[model samples]
Target: MSTTTAPAAGTSTTGGPFSWTDDGAAVTVTLDGVQVLTYTYAANDPQEESPRPYFHPVRTRTGDLVSAYRPHDHVWHKGIAWSLPHLGPDNFWGGPSYRRGQDYRWLPNNGAMRHRELGQATDDDGTFRFAHSLQWVTQQGSLVVEEERSFQVVPGTDSSYTLVFDTAMTNVSGEPIHIGSPTTEGRENAGYGGLFWRGPRSFAGGSIIGPGGATGEELRGQRAPWLSFVGQHDETCRFSTLVMVDDPGSEHPEPEWFARSEPFACMGPAPFFSQEVLFEAGTTLHYRYGVVIADGQSDAQRSEALALAARELLAATQGRNGQ
Candidate 1:
């Protein structure tokens, strides 16, 4: 028993107020301390959103699972550990988040997404001027994915937090969704979200993708696609984001990079069109991605954090030329 329909078509939360939870199925949105967007419209789940939801910067120690590779306590190297909204299960080894946790699909870590907040981790300014639009339709309607992720805390900018990702993915499922880029073709296919490293061997050298680190504009494939690798942990830095589709005239071919010298390093498969992606039920997709968490990674501070996340996703598309 689950149903919710309201905030969409222009948004206006003003980052003013926030809070939600639906134990029955899905829907968890908490944008105060920073982020937490869990919305599963059923039809198979796991692609979660936690911590930021349940309530405030709550994470006293959600089952603490760290060790396989250190980095200030596993910063969710994979997808949501156990929200079950997007399915993440692949513990093939248990270390490095299950060494790829079977590409993750298994959900629920009990504790019902454990959460609880009161204070500490706020920016105020309302935190981010709210703009809300929510929709989750299923049942033969196929699928509709509309999500609004807003952020704010730029009074002077210190702890820093100014994000904005308004997404809309309606396929209804007839064919033709063709939405790639789960690190470019689900990186190893399991959950559709990844990042793994085991430590030592010189902390597994770094650099994941290319273009000073990460950047994609009007991307299709080949014609000099990409596959990256950059390593270093002592100083804080890591990279590995491949790009592949299928091969042959390669709309999505494989190997633009590969180096797995038996746990030695270097691996970029860059799979694009998972298996020839296509959609037609109603065909809908709006892209947005900017995972910027910087402080080190040279080359002039990783090209100044990819030019400040490409100038805020180029003012959110007003200035096209996106990637």
Candidate 2:
């Protein structure tokens, strides 16, 4: 993989509402001098976990940690990651491979999305945007896909901020590859993948909000444009909200959502929830999502408003990129 020089540790500069510090392995973004989130491109996770880039310690503007990392139940469950469970015979989501008849088992099919090089970056106009080039390689050292991923942190109200994530992957393997989740492999309701988020332990039993005034785990496998989770913090007992919106212009406009609040609080727009998407050789797939992290609990109306704001931000970004 090609390498590039990373900014020196402690190197920081202020833009409009954001300032970022690069500590060699990660970039920590702060709003008004208070840390909000840290994106780690050089994660040192074990190969079995399919080491990949992730965002951890994601906090609301008020400093309440909403993201989790390396939790006991699922060590592979990072804070917020662009993870995929089944990529043909490879397991890019880490953990055990869910077989058709064998159930979950550790296989030699784990893959990693290794960072290749840094791309364009802009920290101005109350926003911070960056891109990265990555390689999706299987455990056997075979290249499967080349990806260009970009992230944008945009200014929002005092209680919230918007994070836009975009990924374009080109199949480089000679044969067709199928991307799917556990449900597609016969395991029921386990379709958890694609820009997944793992909430803090305290978030268990949190409230869920979706489009159309929907709520609860029943929203799982249901098509939705956006979803939000409201959870209370540990000590402060204050509430926070996380809203995720799937770009309507994506290949899968309104994807089925994989959400949970019982055992744990987690959610994501599962593009390949019930079926597998086949990518022929040399083909490309692109997806974009927007997330809003806010300090207070968001009711159905508030959640929808936040989702709309995120959608608007995403649309503006897409227009700028000529997508």
Candidate 3:
């Protein structure tokens, strides 16, 4: 008995009948995707926008990308490159300056850079598919944080799609890769960038970003574990999906993040790494993440989604390397 399925309805995110594997552990879609990415990793300080200025979703049921993130400045996500690691006074919002030097006070936002490079995508398995890209961000000649992102998708019976992310970072320059090895990293006072998730208020913790339990000064919010960010209408959880991203080689390895953190929101340090991987010619690093988008947050749904996300991520990777 072969384990596979075809989306029931409304599951054609990229147009072509995105196949499935193991229920709904993942998903695959190829619409007008922009493929989000960045150069800098951490938004150490409050910048013009989010540390992750880019967004890429695998299966939105439409052959076209989502245009832009539904929320926020309509900053055009789906298929656009992006970055955020350091910076100075934000110029995008109000052109980065106080009308009056005395009233507003133009405080220095420090050094930060935003850059991105094109990524690769592929898919061959008749069951699933995937897409991969990269991001580059750094300060003005300060430090750089780059990300290699891969988006995978698994289709299910009820128009469900599981999304997975494989994340990796490399030191383009001949230097070491920082790590809070066995823990987070930073200037201590800088409160090392934490993996956080934003959820409802009643969910216990407010909107804060930091390690679980251990709160940081620049608190944002976090989500509960074993769950993914899914909307709710009445008693039903809409848009079922499970997304998991962990870098085994990362500082702490299996990063401690909440289950409800879908679409993903977090950061890490790369420049200060004592484990810097010197690049004689082209120094690069890598990380792998996983996501499972499914139907309603259910025990059966999540499991199925994970399998799908993993399969799609692996399947769609054929398009990389100009394959």
Candidate 2 regions off by >4 Å? 9-15, 319-323
lDDT of 3 by residue, 204-228 (tens): 2211222232333232222212223
lDDT of 1 by residue, 38-66 (tens): 33322122222222111111110111111
Query: Considering lDDT, which of the candidate structures 2 and 3 is the better prediction for this target?
Result: 2
* Cα lDDT of model 2 by residue, 38-130, tens digit: 988877789899999999989888899999999999999999999998999999999999999999999998899988887755675667776
lDDT of candidate 1 at residue 80, scale 0 to 100: 17
TM-scores for all candidates: the values are 0.22, 0.96, 0.45
Off by over 4 Å in 1: 1-126, 134-161, 166-168, 173-176, 179-323
lDDT of 3: 0.32
Model 3, residue 284: distance off in Å is 3.5
Give the candidate number with the greatest TM-score.
2
TM accuracy, model 3: 0.45
Number of clashing residue pairs, candidate 1 = 61
- lDDT values for all models: 0.29, 0.87, 0.32
